[model samples]
Target chain A: MSKFIGLIRNEHMKTFRRLSTWIMFGIAAALLITIAAFTAYYAEDSSGDWRADTEQQMQDLQKQVENGDVEAAAVQQDLTTMQYQLDQDIAPVQSDSLASYMESVMYYCAPFLILFIAIIAGGLVSTEFGTGTIKLLLTKTPSRFSVLTSKYVSMFITTVIFFIFFIGFSFIVGGIFFGFNGFDAKSVIFDNGETVTNNLLASTMRDYGLNFVQTLIYATIAFALSTIFRNTALAIGFSIFISMFFPTISFILSRYDWSKYILFNNVDLTVYNPGNVPAVDGMTLGFSIVVMAIYFVIITVITWFSFMKRDVTA
Target chain B: MQKQPAVEIKQVTKVIRGRKIIDRVNFSIYPGEVFGFLGPNGAGKTTTIRMIVGLMGITDGDILIKGNSIKTSHGAAMKHIGAIVENPEMYKYLSGYLNLVHFARMSDGVDKERINEVIELVGLKNRINDKVKTYSLGMRQRLGIAQALLHRPDVLILDEPTNGLDPAGIREMRHYIRNLAEKEGLAVIVSSHLLSEMELMCDRIGVLQQGKMLGVQQVHEMSSEQTQMVSFQVEPLEQAAIVLRDMGSKKPEIKDKQIIIELTRDEIPAAAAKLAKEAISIYGIQAETKTLEDTFLELTGGKEIV
Candidate 1:
């Protein structure tokens, strides 16, 4: 067990010591700062009467519901949340508030997180083969299984580190752009036709957690492709292609009842959150969990087996 | 009493994509000996080395390192083996010390002291902290040796250890490899297509051609055991040939105004005395020793060794 940890530590050293990793971190931070600056630049004044703004948003949502401009259930949920905010005298968090900026930019950051993780995971195994270091790596005391598992575990650890960096950096940047006064802000959530009040931090954490799951699935795809193909470029390219296009493909295929089984359709567990809709008409959080679990297992098994049984001819 | 073989390859065969890359190859290397795998390109030397190091699968038979079968107990088997297959390709982005540390952590009980010791042994202490990309090829090769020796394995396998090195670097590597086998009592396996390099570095060499083991021979004995072609530049070449034929020399031929005949080391003096007694004036006598290159060419049917 200690040896395995040593392997993981070795992998971490290799990953973090590279200039490319720090470049990725720099790009992620730049992206967050840019988004925060843009949000601040364009943010409208929200210091007016909160009750008037809630009524205005509710009226707009009602008009959209009547005109069928959006799904009635989703708009109805939004309407209920706004009404609950008004009834509880809880003002809607300003768009420029620290918590609101973080939440708004969190979804935008998810794709970048997936992209970064995909790039990292894609090169994790294939780079060894490309550089011909796999010979030295696998010839050690640890088994091939242990080596690959350590690499994967270290990839996850990197993802977690990147996540914390993203959250932490965004918080600091968001606080700079917008005052850090929304830490105790309340958020009104509509779940199953019922309104519930939750703190901003809790809801933001929940959203970040779900987004992390999505990033993990994408990372797994990239990692599996890396093992199977032994080409870092192709693995990263295919992963990026999938992340970029799978949603549209899933949407086109969603008309078919079997489309829910597609990984992309089930990967976005955020759809189970209130005021959002699943790609398919009937995918519960439980069902998506099972589907994602199956995919996760299958991809992980294929990756491990492929890596273990491969001949390191490179 | 015989020492146990540090590494044993028993009829190992590798079939890739319906083609036999390595066919029933067998050899063994005991401790304190340098075993050289001499073969041409595409002769399955790297493939066989990869199999021994668990980089490639063995289609048939097995490899045993320190009495542990690589197929059945790879972890245990690998613990006793250190190998650099084809090239000493380290992570160029990491410093040389970190690269050694990376490999050191993969094995059991290899500490910072051992890492520093190997760095000193390889003479890389001056630039051990430099990134690998900044090191010269010779420095990288030395670092490669350093990483392989970190665990102190019984068997050290290096495929083309002198590849891409200057002459001085090659000589240094040869000395290092020989010292490892002799002083440290490690069974060293060095693979190269250069016959002269093998002759200088290896105690014994196994010639592999077309994925088959032709023969394994002691490096010193291979040249001396064979008959040599002795040429006599005589006043009368035909007369010398006839005198040599009368003396029962086999296939004495007169060519280029010289008589050439095959003679063993023991027969050379007798033939010389006979020629002197026959009144044949010998202007010059040149005895060409049979080199390992000649034997290798003969064994592989003159296939290109480079």
Candidate 2:
């Protein structure tokens, strides 16, 4: 077990040793600041205080209605009622993307950040073949499983540390500007045109926790891709493309329902919010979670086995 | 004394795609022995080494370390071994000591003292503090050997151990390796492309060609079972061989047209000095000795160097 952990620690050191990793840390910091700046500067002014705006607009509509215009009076009464419902319907929807974009930046940042991690890490596995270092590693350890386990463990711990920084930095940045008080999801709109509201804390926690887990998942997928492809640039490109496009692909696949089991479909932590499930008759966030979990396990298991069995004499 | 067979490869074969990379190889190396795996480029030396370490699987047959199958007890078998395959692919960002420290933590029964001892043993005491990137190629190789020796395993396998080293560096490495084998009684298998170096260093030599084992012979036996060598120096080497051939010198190797012979004082003086008298300027007169390279090419028919 100590041996296994050492192997893991070795890989973790590789990440730590790279200047690019620090560069990624710097990039993540910059991206978080950018998101903060973007959120503060151009975000819709009616973001969290939507109901207040509706109320204010209604008062002005009523004043104009009262100025001797009977036709306007009837319109104001209906308009005010409509405004109240519209506020109830729209504020939460607006808040969800706003929150998700924040989560998206935090949660999916691994894929974006993997643009750096994968290229650095791609050589970690393939280089053993290229350089013949795998022989040293295998001959020293007792088992290939332990050898590979150590590598994954090391990468996981490293990713966990980065996750701490990324999630912490994102929340801090989001809190200072966006005000973390409204992180709850009041309502969420499903891709299939359905709606569910009032999942506040559960949804918020899910999104927040998934921010870290998603990075791990992205890392694992990128790792497997990097191993299979043996090229860092392709791995990074594919990881970014898959992580970024999976949700959209899932959204488009909602017309087919069967495509829901795709791994990319559920990477969106916001998909687990209150209302993002497709009305594909039998699908739920649980199913998406199950699918992603399967992909994660399968990719990981295959990666472990393949690396151990590989003939790294390139 | 031979403690036991540390590693044994029996009729092992490896095929990639449609080609046989390694074919029906068989050999054994005992504890407290320095076995040299010698071959030329692409002769499957690396492939065979990898197979023994279980970095690769045998397409057929078995590889056993300390009498345990590398496939089944691979993890457990590795606890008995240490190896370096090629260029020292260590964590470049970590200091040499940190790298050793980290590798030490993985192997059982290795501690800080052991780490420091191995660092000193490899003669990297002063530079061990520097980052691996800052270390010279020779320093890196020494550090690599330090990491491999940290666990004090029963067997140490080094692939191309002396690949890139200056004379001083190679001397340092050879001293430490020989010391480990003699003083500690550690079994070692070192691969080298330089046959003369192997002849000088290894107890037994395994000649490899294109992934096949041509022969495994003791170093003394290889040298003792003399092959034909011609060793008379001739000025204007080209003119000498041509004249020797014209004189019905069957299978004669005429360098500068000066003939060298295995025959001692009697047979050599007549042919070589006679050639000298025949206008091949005999600046130096000497007998020929069989070098490992000549024996290797002769036995394997220069099949392939891997």
User: Could you say which candidate leads in DockQ?
Assistant: 1
**Which lDDT tens digits does candidate 1 get at residues A1-314?**
99999999999998899898999999988888888888888988764898987798788888887888988877766777787888889988777889887887787888889998999999999998999998899998899899999999999999999889988888899888887677988877766668877787667889899989989989989999999999999999998998899987987898999999888888888888876789888889999999999999999898899898878879
Q: Candidate 1: misplaced stretches above 4 Å?
A: A46-83, A189-196, B222-226, B230-263, B266-287
lDDT of 2 by residue, A23-124 (tens): 878888988888778656765656457676767777777777677554684664456444545756655434324454455565546466555545554556
lDDT of 2 by residue, B1-306 (tens): 345688888899899997998989999888778999987788888888888877788889998888888877776677778888777787777788888877787788898899988887777888888888898888888888888888888889888888889987777777777777888888899998777677767889998887888887777553323444556677777666665554333545654556644443344555665676767777776544455566677878855434
DockQ of each: 0.80, 0.54
Model 1, native contacts kept: 0.92
Clashes of each: 0, 17
Which residues of candidate 2, in runs, are more than 4 Å off?
Answer: A37-54, A59-124, A127-132, A171-203, A247-252, A275-282, B1-3, B221-287, B302-306
| Model 2 alpha-carbon miss at residue A49, Å | 11
Model 1 lDDT, residue A147, Cα: 92
lDDT of 1 by residue, B1-306 (tens): 199999999999999999999999998999999999988888899999989999899999999998999998999999999888877899998999999989988988899999999899999999999999999999999999999999999999999999999999999999999999989999999998778889899999999988999998787663434677888888777777777885434789888888888877677778888889989887888876455678788898987777
Evaluate all candidate structures by whole-model CA lDDT and list the values in order. 0.88, 0.70
- Give TM-score values for chain A, per-prediction: 0.89, 0.70
